[model samples]
Target: MNAAKPTASLFQRPAWVALFAFTAAFAWGWAYPLIKLGFAEFGIGRDMTGSKMLFAGIRFCLSGLIILTIARLTGRSFSLKEDGRKSVVGSCLFLLLFALLNTTLHYAAFYIGLSYSLGSRASILNSLSVFALVLLACAFYKSDKLIFRKVLGCVTGFLGIMALNLGGEESGAFTLMGDGLIIANALCGAFAGLMTRGVNKRVDVFVGTGYSLSVGGALLVIPGLMMGGTLHNVTPWGIVILALLIGISTIGFTLYNKLLTCNPMGKVAIWNSLIPVVGAVTSCMCLGETFYSKYALAAVLAATGIYIINKGKK
Candidate 1:
């Protein structure tokens, strides 16, 4: 990433960069519809309970291997050692903890939550990570202070979250399957982000991410299989789609991270608003659901909050 920093600056060409950023962001957004389509194709449903986890496990595991392969082909280091001279034990330990926090627990809850929730709702609610991380960082890191704008931003974001849940008993009420699971998923993801910050100083960033995803995802498959999840309904076309989803994860994450490493964090961070926006819109289209004005309002509030947080001075 450091060596490629110069080239990435070329990507910072305002118009072209915006296009690249949106395209990358759209790939992540694509996951919303693709995951649902996977569920439908495999005959998985909310009632299946374990199938979603199983499906996510496969996607992450495959994506992880793909990433690792790319890293190796590009001659990137996977060493856990900060300076490439650490013991095998230390490296193994780093991979273990990273996999646990970043992939295993995080996606288990996320996929399950997404299973029971509307894609549009899931996209909006999952944006809670920004606010949640603000609070988490304040508690854990000396440098991350909460000021007036941040607090106000967090409030605005939370209000947007509340707005999404106001329709009625069917859509509004929190269930273990809906709001409950997504909130848990967001917390886990925030922690994972923090964990990444910590471990990046100790190991190769790409290596840690790749290995953790592979290990954690493989572990998820165990519980899913024990819980009776199966991919018996998958077809050749479904396999092709699943492959596409994995490609999204692999390419989307790498590019997003690379851009962040190469440019101003604020510049890259603002593009994230596109993730939920694209996810909600595409999910609505895929589900054949009508667009509601509330979704727009929610997206704006949440996006504004994220902007404020990232734009804060150090």
Candidate 2:
């Protein structure tokens, strides 16, 4: 009888998973500028909360449907057999909070902030989510250890953020509300990350994602309808954006879940620092935005921070 070949171990699976996660982060980073463009096309701004909600709702709904179809065609099971009730309940709560805070605030605030701030500054500021996650991890879950190396990494990353900010034109009307919204958006993302850890303990990742997206998308539609975001103004470009959102969400979230399963939360969190660099580069290249020394400096700092953080782990 022929000897059976050994299957890849869990640790071995992470190399490919981490690579995909990084790619997904890069794609998502580009999505910032794309979303900004879409909002501009629609003449929507931060003050247009209703319109923003509507736009986000439509994008998520379209993406969710596409993901559902793809999941089915791929022969991936959709049934929430394990913790079906808990998953549904948890997903519903997550959806409500996420749509209300994370989705709405993130898009609206980001667009508004980008108008006031430079692309590099906005991108680097966005990396503060890592800081938020770190604090949350330390306080709530104790899932990660807070050592000198991690602290150094975070400090370096913050310096990158500072570099990016220093290169940008300052917004004169920096309101408490706007800053609050951005901070809240980061907190929501961190909370969502934490919540996913809990949910994944019981259900499969795809099923959980499907549930969250469906419920969250549906909730977003209600506010969207109230805001007059009809099917009338959606252009071909809008449709393309919607399609990309779904594709990325499906692939990115799935891969992220796999990575989380295989690696420490802190390690995965550090990868987030790469997002700003990717976003800034993509925006400059695709949208003809200008690049500056500050952006390069920020990238270097963030890269160094990520390396330091991850190196200490191994």
| lDDT top scorer | 1
Regions more than 4 Å wrong, model 2: 1-12, 73-117, 167-180, 230-233
What tens-digit string does per-residue lDDT give for candidate 1 at 1-314? 45655443565566766676777778977787788888889888777767877898899898889889988999987755554245567657766876887678878887888887888888888878757766776677676666877788888888888778676665545678777888987787666655665455666677666887788889888888989998869798789879999888787656654554345444554566677788899988988755677778889898878767666443
Error of 2 at 74 (Å): 4.5
lDDT of 1 at 86: 59
How well does model 1 score by local distance difference test? Answer: 0.75
> Where does candidate 2 clash, by residue pair?
none
User: Model 1, 31: alpha-carbon shift in Å?
Assistant: 1.2
* Model 2: lDDT of residue 103: 46
lDDT for each residue of candidate 2 in 1-314, tens digit (9 for 90 to 100):
99999887553466765676687677667766776666666666656666766766766666656666667788876655455455677755654554444344444554445554545446666777776676567666666777787788778877866665453354222234544445455566676666666555555555555655656666677867886655445678876766676666666656665565556666676677777887788778766777777778878888887787778455
